[model samples]
Target: MRDLQADLAICEAATPGPIQMKPCACGRCNQFLLSITHADGRFDPENAKFIVEAREGWPEAIQRALKAEAEVVTLTNQLYNCGKAVFERDQARQERDNAEDKVDRLEDELRMLQDALNQRYQP
Candidate 1:
């Protein structure tokens, strides 16, 4: 039960291409996690340990969370703009083709009219 458009909006709303991120060892925040055991250079699935130093400055953590929320919003906006532009471009192309078809029809009609005039005036 996931909204597909909302999912795609995450990237289109952000930028033209995919989002890039720097890899982290053990997925540890440097400000947090004084030490990480095993040094796997990646997040450990089984032997993961996160030791909280202190909870004195929860506001800073909250701010970090909000920053992540802002990133999501920015990404969604990018996707929305990209999708809109694509839609508009498609519409424009369709309109142009329709106009071209109309011009072709008019040209054919003019040719028919010229042929009729010639037949009527021919000796």
Candidate 2:
């Protein structure tokens, strides 16, 4: 399984700003560009720290992947909880059986002692 916590940590540590997509204005073939803008709306394409080429369907694909990851995390946690619950239930059942067996043995001992006393008194 992928480490969900690590992925969350990475996202938390990423650039604290909004991502922007702008059209390439070099008068060349039509293309789109991507960049992370600071909180104050400052952007520098020439000195961008990180840049990614925007391809058709890339954004949608990324969104789908994120949704899938979230679902995986939720399902994995539920599965772990279910397994733990089953183990606890089994443990409780074993303890109950042990207690019932102990009670039966004690009852048998009491009956034996009672019978012996009755025989002695009759004699």
Candidate 3:
């Protein structure tokens, strides 16, 4: 919400020039502006997608908002990946510990059996 308002403010600050007609990626003939609005602009997450008309300053604002949104999404993905890695590491450590304990128990049983056989043969 804050980001939307900030981008709008940037658009409002720019001169209200003519809207430039351009080809949008959505295969539409769209008008673009590079303008900013005031600090007290109305808020909407989808504000970047909707231009009030073909104003000069609005295009730049929209671009900034889109870029910021992308960055936020990337950071969120990184955070989730980091958490998953930590969980995997912990699971691996627990498995290794369990295996080591089993090896120790088996070695102890083998030693006891060997001692009993030696005592019987020597006597």
Per-model tally of clashing residue pairs: 10, 0, 17
Residue 23 in candidate 3 has what lDDT? Answer: 36
Best by lDDT: 2
The top-ranked prediction according to TM-score is 2
1 or 3, greater by lDDT: 3
Candidate 1: Cα lDDT at 68: 86
lDDT of each: 0.58, 0.67, 0.64
Backbone clashes (count) for model 2: 0
**Model 2 agreement with the true structure over 32-108: per-residue lDDT tens digits:** 56565554546454323223222323465577789999999999999999999999999999999999999999999
Give the TM-score of each candidate: 0.52, 0.53, 0.52
Give candidate 3's TM-score: 0.52
Q: Hey, what RMSD does candidate 2 come out at?
A: 8.3
lDDT string, candidate 3, 34-117, tens digits:
333334443343344345432544566577779989999999999999999999999999999999999999999999999999
Task: Order the numbered candidates by TM-score, best leading.
Answer: 2, 1, 3
In model 2, which regions exceed 4 Å deviation?
1-56
- CA shift of 99, model 1, Å: 0.5
Which residue runs does candidate 3 get wrong by more than 4 Å? 1-57
